[model samples]
Target: MSGGCAVTLDDLTVALRALRLLAVDFPHLPAPDVDVSPVFPEWLRLSLHDTSCESLSAFEQWRTALRIAPEAVDSRTQSGGRTRVLKAEGQFAGAVIVLTAYADEPAADRAPAGQAGGVR
Candidate 1:
């Protein structure tokens, strides 16, 4: 919140939308599922499948250890995948982690040179 510019709820919404698009467009990596609470002030929940649970958990722990206003919890899946949940209250204005799934091949491999890569 005290990073730079004061972010409004609307800004968070826009960021969430962008994150969703990235997830849908790139699912092989860390595709994040974002859920925004419809309450006043605004609250955001992000879920993603991380191959490295320890790393994600460490990140969640670091957030709290640093005394960050927001709180984050990292959970593990039965399949050994990791999920992270972050919550912020009162017009939460801050950065949201968007995990992008990495592909073995470059996006360009699936697309003609100079063309954008996307599912057809």
Candidate 2:
């Protein structure tokens, strides 16, 4: 296999192992949205949609379970800063795995129409 193909295989293996671990360790968490593209086979992303509180809690727990450092935690916004996603990156079996968790929408965005009082 080409080097990229081998790395992709490794990434898939790591992602499956991580998912199995999370299923066993954090059964209450909903299944994440798994994504892997042939174009970017070196990385894997598992995204969870949960309340920020719940997502943050799970992120910490998963990182601890994976033995990833607490300092790995980070965050970024999407939808022009209206959506925030908590993120952590770690390696399993030498393959990069990224865990991202975010709520369906920001609290302010979820406010009843016209309640938050901002222009559309």
Candidate 3:
């Protein structure tokens, strides 16, 4: 974890504040699936799964809210052409926040449950 910020109580506080902002600022969107890692460089990952347009829009909104540079965003198609993921990273009050969204694909192309679903 070299070059990573050390996790601290302050980082958790920042994460909570960000969550609150999401709730208040974007009420139309569904609750995001969230993940918090307490290891070095503590991070919070928020994700949504829906139509490509919706997810992509959510990603854009979050990236703007977090003030992440547009150059930081990255997108790639999955191996099977079932879905694509767009990701971006930013720092908020010493906490790393990662925003991701999965674009939906045809139901028949999806993998079985408990298998290689998507990036976690």
- The most accurate candidate by TM-score is 3
TM-score of each: 0.26, 0.58, 0.64
> Candidate 1 vs candidate 3: which has greater TM-score?
3
- lDDT (Cα, tens digit) per residue for candidate 3, span 19-120: 666677777665678876555335678897787568778778778877899888886656455687888899865667888988866677666655564543
Each model's lDDT comes to 0.38, 0.63, 0.72
Query: Candidate 2 versus the native: TM-score?
Result: 0.58
Ranking by TM-score: 3, 2, 1
| lDDT by residue (tens digit), candidate 2, 5-101 | 3454654565566556656876765566778655555466777677555766766666776677867777655555445567888876455778877
Q: How would you encode candidate 1's per-residue C-alpha lDDT over 1-120 as one tens digit per residue? A: 325556565645644664555456545443245565434223344443344444355434434433444423322222112222233222223434322122123233344545444432
Residue 88 Cα positional deviation in candidate 1, in Å, after optimal superposition = 8.7
* Clash number for candidate 2: 0
- The predictions' CA RMSDs to the true structure, in order, are 15.3, 5.9, 6.5
Could you tally the backbone clashes for each prediction?
Answer: 3, 0, 0
